[model samples]
Target: MTLVAYAGNLNNRANVWVSLLAEERRRRAVRAVAEQDHAAVWELVEAFMAFRSQSGVLTSVHTLRSYRTGVRQFLEYAAEHAVNVLRPGRDDAQRYINALVAGGKKVLTVRSRVAAAVTLYKALRWAEATEANPFEETFAPQDRMHALEKVPPYQERVVRRVLAAAQERIAQAQPDELDRATAVHTLLVVLAHGGLRIDEALNLEWKDIRLEDDELRLVVRSGKGRKSREVPLSRSAVEALRAYRALPRTRKHPPRKVFPFASRSSAMYHVRPLFDEHGVTDWRGFHALRKYMGSRLYENLEDFAAVAEVLGHANVNTTKAYVRVGNERARKVLRDW
Candidate 1:
């Protein structure tokens, strides 16, 4: 489907008088709607955009742009399929969703577009502009849950095996290569124990780590949404890091950062293979470490807010998606019952 055609066409209207600087930034949404072919749907889009602006719902310029782009695409799909935007049926909505998924759009993208469609309809409905709400019924009960989008947490056994491999590799390295081995070992431990995103781990400087007499912590400087939080470090991870820092390679030229690795790709070069060799499936990248941390923290602390805070998630529901209950725990709960 030509997703950009509707926006592109709308953006090129001869009568519209937008500044070149504004048009150059790909401002597809805020343009004046001069298209009379689909005036009915266009009117609804205008009303919805106005409503979003007035209700303070569109917090960011990005969100407003997304809603505009997505709604226009939906209208284009509706016009082509001979479906009424104001009174759409279940089949009409499903077809649009299916087309988006089949056309290789990410699930989240399709879902977000559908949500934009829903917001438009709701605004129209509230204004007595439409009688039906198709987008609401189009998504299944299960589809509304973001669980499928979540990264599957790493199995405890798999995590243990990966750590074991790192230790084994450290032991097998020659004396002259001990520093590299120590760095790799420490890297894996920091990820597994601290539950840091690979980028967060890569950004770690010596100053971020606090190896206090009674406690250890790593201050996450750059978290999701640029939020920062302090995460407790495991004893094993702290010790591994200590060993890595003491090595001749590290001591001779102390790193500006805690981990010797420079980039996420470079760190992954040393880290991913450990799991790859063990035939790990569903490789969720370093984010899985954060998921594992979320799950473990929830299990131990029984606090969603606390887990959300540590992971630097603004929403607790997002944290819920990150944490996964283990199969063993599920089976045990059932068996005891």
Candidate 2:
């Protein structure tokens, strides 16, 4: 029976109808797998994502986008190589990984794509859509370097230079360009001080800013893993924000969001030139600012747990990766030895 007709007949039991619809989709997916229908299998992937969204298993749009990209890449590879994704042989996953490696994808990128495939198969199994688990035994190649070794935090001097460049742009901006300049500067200040993820900062509404007597804090309503935390703003950050808010353009009709850039890329377009002008060529973009904040906070507080709290890191170990040890400190310890 058509889903529409079935739903129409079960108007009284809407919940049951929904459940039946999901089961029907699962059955169709199973049939598609058995028939080796690539197009139908792609539809099943979409259905799996929809199911996760409906079930609140996936809350972040960024996460959904990443999963879609990774899964789509895998499916594309499978189709090109004439492999049935749902009925892959034992070596299919390894072959896919080998292809990615052959294409010179970074170790981290390869691992993330593999993880996305693994997640998709696990969800499909839970929904009874397919019994195939091609990626169950497959593993991505391990990176020889640790996270800290990969990208060190931006130095304090470099950060200061970038911030100064931003301030100069704000000062020299034309009347028509004043708002954009001020907004970018404020964003940089927040990133430098708040240690927030770029998404978290971009998503901030004016309501998230909490200002008390001589102090300022930002409320991140939805962070990684759908968690929420408050990060206290530094004195300089507070001043920058206040200055931005007091601008005639901002005061006339303040935007609902703190930074009114359309997307993350749009925001980066304004800030990236400043970074390039300065020698911060890590390519991590705004994240380097976050790492700078984490490292500075750890240096001052000397408390891993406290730094983790400020950075909204779930684990202290993750926070440690963000904090960089200075060469001078290492030299001092070695000299003592």
Candidate 3:
């Protein structure tokens, strides 16, 4: 919302072409179509973007950019199919799906594209079969989906290597000697053991941690879906955190957010290098560390329900995917027989 407001406010007015800037901005919000069709598609796309914005999903400018790309493609599809009509041919729907696959996109990536199209479909749904309801026909079949590229399961050995490697990296680093290293490693444990999203991990405050207890649990104030939950702490995690807290805090510093960086980007700059040095592939993303962490917990505990609780997932199903056990593990047990 802040970014949206800032982008909205950019103008020279008497000295600059404010209206032209606004026109260009609006055009960016939708994908291109024929000159005659662009207006309608843009109008619909803007309304959808505005709705997501109001709901807070479109909070960041980069997020708006992603939405722009998705919605633009949707507009083209809608226009090509003449979605204004009550019934679009089934062929129209398949062609669009084929086009996405033809671009060499994975099923999951294409799923995101279809999801955006579905969102538009729902937002625009009336007494209409426009675009032959493309979403329904494409994703309803399990085999077709199975044939689409799926993320390969993270093998047990790889998952263990990742976690053990993280610990080794932390052991090798002298936190007191390196504040940036210390901060990044400490936060990684929070994501791994505390079952926190990267954003929530980054957003932690001093009050969120309960260190005095024999166990450590973090109170995540804002999480996905804007819901909150408490994540359990491990013994190693408690000790590391206690050590981190004993470090300096400025009088001018904010009460919350224990690891507030100069900015989110600066934190990433520090974290990325550490991941590169440590041989962990997650420097590019906090969620990858998150994925392995969940896997480690699930393998050890063999309890998806508990993992879900720690991860603050409303549904255990989501947690299961994060730390999913594979058929290979099941085969090992069967082989023992």
Candidate 4:
């Protein structure tokens, strides 16, 4: 199959996967072109992988996988242009980024691609080649971030209804599938109530649970920047987890992750399909949970600082976006009003 044609599905975007795969093979020659340092790229990635493994801080496998795609694309583009990758001067990096933007890539795409490039550059210490790391001179944030186009708040009912249907399917499945269903349900609760990204939800472990003053708390070990943060478990979340723990577990091993069967992949692997199966059209993925959590939390709390703590955000500015509480359904709101 042609490279793009081979990557056939939403699950992995086959074209990107195939391209990254080819890049992995080509990386050796890209680095140290004069010396044919074929393994230079691999060595760089492996160094990050090893650091992540040993330091227990630098790498989450989910993030590492993304770097694979981003850096591979950079190397692939460099190879096509006949640029000696291992020795790409700083201007070359600038051109590579500009070329991507010039080729009709959206701002988010451009930013993500640049971020990916930055990761590889940092991984191999490529940034030091520039007196100031030309990438550091990014004078402004990408348009995607500054321009806020949230899914309309009215859509919460759409998402919640869809989730409710997904719950019914879970409740009716056979015993074997029921375990998976229960796992799915538990994950849903984490998304719905705990406001966790799917990977954060999947990587959750029993040991992270701390009950203090009768309130349940969750400590997420793998987060952006590997910053460990705490999330308060709502009563529904607490009860769902308790019931989930009561359910039969697959791993005989103690203190492993919550969703043992889940792997390090995109969060959509869990959330997106539910919409397809239930026919909830145009639905986004797990980040909706953050929105749901943020909107709901604002009803009870006013300060973004508290919301930031609740959502595990490093920056209060990020938490501000989440705290905008839209008016709820008229019936729900007018129960006494």
TM-score list, all predictions: 0.59, 0.84, 0.63, 0.72
Candidate 1 lDDT tens digits, 160-190: 8888988998899998767777777787788
Please give the lDDT score at residue 147 for candidate 2: 68
* Candidate models: Cα lDDT each: 0.69, 0.76, 0.59, 0.63
- lDDT (Cα, tens digit) per residue for candidate 3, span 1-337: 3432233321211112123354453453232233435445434444444443354333443344455566678666667667532345666656677788887876666766666666555434421213335567664212343211233333445444544655566567664544444566677667656767767777788888898776468788867766788878888678778866776654234646677564556667766665466565634365665666677787788888888877778898777666646765988899989
lDDT of 1: 0.69
Each candidate: how many clashes? Answer: 0, 0, 3, 4
Poorly placed runs, candidate 4 (over 4 Å): 1-39, 45-57, 86-91, 119-141, 144-154, 210-213, 250-255, 264-267, 326-337
Candidate 2 lDDT tens digits, 1-337: 6454332211222233235566786776677656656455544554455454442433455665676688778767877898876668889999999999999999989998997788668656755776889877886899988666677677888878888999999899998789888988889889888999889988888788876755478899868877789899888888888887777754333377788776778888888999787776765777777888888888888899999998888899988778867665798899978
Q: lDDT order of candidates, best first?
A: 2, 1, 4, 3
Q: Is candidate 1 or candidate 2 better by TM-score?
A: 2
Q: Where does candidate 1 have its weakest 10-residue lDDT segment?
A: 25-34
Cα misplacement distance, residue 117 of candidate 4 (Å) = 2.9
What CA root-mean-square deviation does each model show from the true structure?
A: 9.7, 5.0, 7.5, 8.8
lDDT of 4 by residue, 147-222 (tens): 2254432256765776686678778988777656666667777877877777777778889986555658899987
Ranking by TM-score: 2, 4, 3, 1
